[model samples]
Target: MGKVWCVGISPTDPRLVGIEGVTFHSTVNGCDTLLVATNKNGLGGISALEDNVLIMHESLATATAKGLHRMVVLGDTSSLEGRRWKVHAESWDSTMGVSVNSIHGMGQLIVEVLARSAALKGMQVILIRVGLATERNINRHLARAFTHSSVRLESFKDSKIPDLDAWTAMCLDESGEFNSEISSEQWAPSRED
Candidate 1:
């Protein structure tokens, strides 16, 4: 409901351009919520550690400094491995297809770190994974990493996806809630079997 901004990417289309007074910025300055998109430099193996870490680190720090608590990240939050797509909820089910190459994006790390920071700051974050069979390993890691109450994960099922208008509308909707098939505490490592 407050001033929502899109970070990392800009809104060129009219639909995503005008949503509840949403604005675009390179930083998370003066915003109540942020919609962050992944950057190109973050798509790599361990060799791209610096790029992956720095982007998320800078974004989180800026958001914290700006008093921003909520964020919706659109990226490759899942580790597709060989699978085409996946849905994270009470459990990791509803998966199909296979990928040509692996897609382990930096989004998982970004979201995980942000979620932890949010947990500490009493904030909330949602990760909306885009694309199919993009990155399965990271997806698996993310499903298990979202143990904190401050974090939630979801994904788009179709190929030509990310209905920006719908997503932004939901992001701005006060009562809007994202679906996490599995509960965060369900897979907590600390939980005794």
Candidate 2:
């Protein structure tokens, strides 16, 4: 089975902060350490590095086959204020009815897409820094669907510092599954198919 690291990012300003808010567990050194940001900007500040940037819309299976071990998820939590966060939370609860709903929804979608591309490859899907907004706002039905799937769901504590380089290194060392022999292929689905 392959490993997948789902890094969560606040939609603040990638320029201002790197990937700070993302979360995931480290499998290296046989220790389970949660990687989180120390600042609000999170890892968004260091997105220029190829290893640190991840397009959420991309298919997970294709990325995994191509040796993509780290995923940076840009969520909508950074844009909310105290009041707005509360409102969003209430709305999400009304919609999904649980905090893990959004994370589950994302996990299921990622798993389905990646599974189709790689024939349902075994993979671990880690949800990083899934705090307040999206945490409370996800659709429960979608989340429940994912919980019954095969993807692994792991969460980390929020960090105050947004360090992209450190997080990238951690992901590569921990969740990276492919070796040098693996080849990178385009995983986009064709409309005609």
Candidate 3:
């Protein structure tokens, strides 16, 4: 509902050639208006004195979380073009297919969801701290299943996610109760698990 100035990726990028108010820049800048799509790196360009709201996009998984394993999380990290994670025997024999590869970019999915919601509410700056705070608890529980308590979570951004989904899989057990048991299945192939 506001006069939103859409910026181009670059002047030569061709997205802003004839657009009335569009401008191009390497980084997000020149706005007293609310900020959106700024990531960790772009945070540097923000002015504290401005009344802008920052809608950032961060990955739920990054290269650090990449590797082979018995079962790889079907996400951006393990799916990078150069990466390859063969299915573990248990998962493969149980499920279908031979291997898993990445195609759809999943890295920034977390913030994208948040950003989309913010955009829906009208180009306002959306503040998201849930993924930021929930990371430790998630890493502590899931990673600890394979590695020690010191496997400090890297840039993986799903920290804001609630604990219910993974720990409390809705899949009913044989007796039709909520599955509340820890899985022995390794989620990712890691160096030390």
Highest TM-score model number: 1
Candidate 1 structure, TM-score to reference? 0.49
Q: RMSD to native for every prediction?
A: 12.8, 17.9, 19.5
Which regions of candidate 2 are displaced past 4 Å? Answer: 1-61, 77-121, 127-193
lDDT rank order: 1, 2, 3
**TM-score for each candidate, following the candidate numbering:** 0.49, 0.23, 0.24
lDDT on C-alpha atoms for all candidate structures: 0.43, 0.26, 0.25
How far off is model 1, as Cα RMSD? 12.8
Off by over 4 Å in 1: 13-15, 42-49, 77-91, 94-103, 132-193
lDDT of 1 by residue, 58-86 (tens): 77677777887666665542333333433
Residue 168 CA error for candidate 1 (Å)?
15
What tens-digit string does per-residue lDDT give for candidate 2 at 101-138? Answer: 23333333343233223322333332222233232222
Quote the lDDT for 43 in model 3.
27
Candidate 3 Cα outliers beyond 4 Å, as residue runs: 1-8, 32-103, 120-193
1 against 3, candidate with superior lDDT? 1
